[model samples]
Target: MRLRRLFLLLLCGLRAEIQEQDVRAMVGSDVRLGCTYPEGGSFDLNDLFVYWQIPVPGKPNTNSVVTYHLPENSSAGHSDSHYRDRAWLSPDRMRQGDFSLQLRNVTPQDEQKFNCLVFRKSLELKKILEVVVTLHVAANYSMPVVSGPSQDEELTFTCKSVNGYPRPNVYWINKTDNSLLDEALQNSTVSLNARGLYDVVSVLRVRRSPSVNVGCCIENVLLHQNLTSGQPEMFAGDKRSVTDGPAHDTLEAGNKPVFSVLGVLVVAVAVAAGWLCRHRCPHRSHAELV
Candidate 1:
């Protein structure tokens, strides 16, 4: 009987030693908070109440806000108003040693130290979790400069962007009517010329009525800020002229007076040729020939 009692004592001591809790996180634009507790503990989660609280900065020993709580089935408990829709408990997977808390639409206000409180029967145990969320804001992206010849000429545009975190996607925005024209003029090319920098060159064959406006937009997926520019500076070959607008002159419709003068000259020449043929003809009538 004494040996059995000693075995029971050893088992209880081992269980107590194994009851461990800790919090870990992966830091970045989106931060994750993790919580883990040893299994085979004396506490029953169903009989226990769980709560999360964040302490106010500069206010030591004072809890600023209650973020979340798991109320008893019979109690008409309520979640903190601020975290009503933002906080959620881990699923069954978490009960099996997975203590991950998913917070959606994370903001700067949510960055703080958090604590997880566990209450079972009349015993209370608490664990602290540190959460640090970094905000990544992308700067504005610049528009491209289109250059080259006018109608029936080769054209090129260079897209540029600056001050973007976590890199930016660069591409040419195209606008064409026909499918063939779209395929021929489409500039889906992209390249990262430098760190956090990008450039794309869009090239196409210029046709009649050659002027066109192209847009370059830089979008930040995390912040959802879009910056777009369509006014591209025109250039003639590798050199940029001091000219104040499109390199080519706008052509007007209809024929000029020069075309009319050329037509009149051709008519006058035809009449003179007919008169010369008549004068060269001899008097070769049928009676004269006999």
Candidate 2:
């Protein structure tokens, strides 16, 4: 009978935790880390204690996110400097057994495993629950910008995007036929910036031809989205082709006509309006806007 009583006491003293969970958050957004307790309630505020912490690699001490001693509801004195004003808990929700955390403006650096521990006081503080939450962070890349051959250059185009998370794929498309250009004819590179974001650059070269229309695409697998920008339909041949290149340049410049043609059209419109005004209003003086 004494052995059975000892077994009961051991079992009663041992506590178990729920399985770990995963959460996905986007960069520059807010997220809630879920945690709860059956008895982290207001019934006995003096007995409840909640703590949120993150384990740092190669460090003996963990980083404190927030700590609440139910009796006082005070933040941990030694909270990590990086998380200051960004991580917080709600006292009103704690009154209803909710000890979740609210994290604001989550960045790529915020990706980590968080530990939530709850303690109940009796003769002393006794751990009652532990929850682990893993956070995965992601961000969308900016729209691609494409630059093509200059007036005196060959048919080389560049496409670039910035402020993306993770590396992304790059492709060159012949917008004339909607077909992807050969990968061998393109060079692509991706690099990480100081802010932990990615920047992508790609260059594509096309053969000398009479006309060419090309597009550059950036594919972010993490965000499952793509951005594309097409060239303004530039020329592809030698100096002799330069004679006709300005036509394409004109089209790219918002379909602006040549100066001579624009001047002639303006003169014709002014003459027509003057004639109409003199004939319609016979008593008016013979004066035109031109």
Candidate 3:
């Protein structure tokens, strides 16, 4: 009976060990790390102490530490200088079996194994939570370029730019007044060939006139309100003068009056012929005997 009792006690201890809590989490996002004792165990929040430490790679070692105690609801200790202001214990949710620690504005440097330890009246338990955080920082912005024929001629303008992190906001701007233009011309058709990367073409019809200046601007919506303009290009038609070409010939323009006069005379002759034929053969039927 003594041997049987000892075996039962050993089995019970093994079961308790298996029931202890564990921790797990992902990177660049929020995570919770804490411990829980078996139900009816002589343990409370005050009896447990929790902390996180980054362990050496493939070895049992640690260089940084963060410790927290309950009720006071504040960090009790920190071995790493970097985590001093960024790591803290969450007071509001810790008492309800939430040994979860809250780390804000997490950086890649904080990624590692975290040790959560619980102690009460000579009974002690420890769980290790592993953390992996990825670092992501967006690069610089690039201005869009506008290309094609000069503005004075009936021409198409194409705007293009590269895709960047945080997805930039791109649009066209009139350089003269610094005002925003319709994504494309109002009467023109606008096609967004690709998102992030884009090409938009706008056609403008201009009469014989002098060169005019225009600009195409691209902007980052989240970072700035001002726009970056493309190099100024003059309209080609604006460079021409009246004396540089032959005199404006209305006849060559297809507006000659002779065509209209001929059309009117033909209509008048047709009407007169119909009137004479009707009078001379009044009441005559083609099929009647002579």
Candidate 4:
């Protein structure tokens, strides 16, 4: 039984099959799909032809990304319009068994399977090799920017993250309590740009608390990466004084001059009453007169 299973496994290995590879690429960046010939076997360019293929959505036919004919020593045809002028093969390394494809200015739509095939023909025999790579594209968004205004007893904060793909999750944090802001206090929106990337914004409104620090956080759930804005503080109450004066002047204004005048008048009246009593008394004890 073991021998039969081993033979089946070996036979399957010899047949053409899909080999998947996961690749992460940022939007507007370049990426390379590496495809090399079978190990321990090499073929001369004179007898080889290589091509790359990708599937088109809602279509039965596969799109030709690029192709090279060794006999002609040139590209056999132009790539699809979407990939034209942006896809190419490494001719310098072709003879060394490397059939890698380089793609430039990639976008979200470029996330798909890339297939590479090589056919070698000789006078007595023909051989074929196939490789398939699955690419996973991702976009990195800019740092979150938080802004807003405080009015009366309410404070509002807005958070924005731009140019990211696959949609991002955005929320607010109250650093004073080490907790995420309640959903009831926040609202968020997302929009796709012309390039198919996402622009996310969130707004948070709550009663003003000057002691708490509020911040915005943006996350790429697919990539498991996150970015947060710097801590922003809130302020409460009407800090402005009535008079347009310096801080010290405002402090001095709180003191009333009428109170100071009244204090002096009370002391003078007490002295006058004591002097009249000393002069008006008809009889007095010796100690008292002295």
TM-score of each candidate structure, all chains considered together = 0.33, 0.66, 0.32, 0.66
Candidates sorted on TM-score, descending: 4, 2, 1, 3
Q: lDDT by residue for model 4 over 1-22, one digit each (tens)?
A: 8334422332343345545667
In the range 180-265, model 2's lDDT, one tens digit per residue, is 77777889989988888888888776665555666666666656666665354443343221111111111343343245557666
List model 3 lDDT by residue over 21-44, tens digit each: 333332234555444433433335
Candidate 1, residues 1-290, lDDT tens digits: the string is 83344223222321222122333222223444554554433433454444455665787765533443343443213245765656666546334544445565544345456554443434332232222223233333343334433323445443444434434443334323111223244354546544433334445443434445444344444434444333344433353322222122212233222323466666764564334223311112211000
* Clashing pairs for predicted structure model 1, backbone only: none
TM-score of 4: 0.66
| Lowest-sum lDDT 10-residue window in model 4 | 244-253
RMSD values for the candidates in order, in angstroms, are: 24.9, 16.4, 25.7, 24.5
Give the runs in model 2 whose Cα sits over 4 Å from its true position: 1-15, 38-43, 58-73, 76-78, 150-154, 176-179, 235-290
Q: TM-score of the candidate numbered 1?
A: 0.33
lDDT of candidates 1 onward, in order: 0.39, 0.63, 0.39, 0.62
- Which is superior by TM-score, 2 or 3? 2
Candidate 3: which pairs clash? 151-235, 152-235, 209-238, 210-238, 211-238
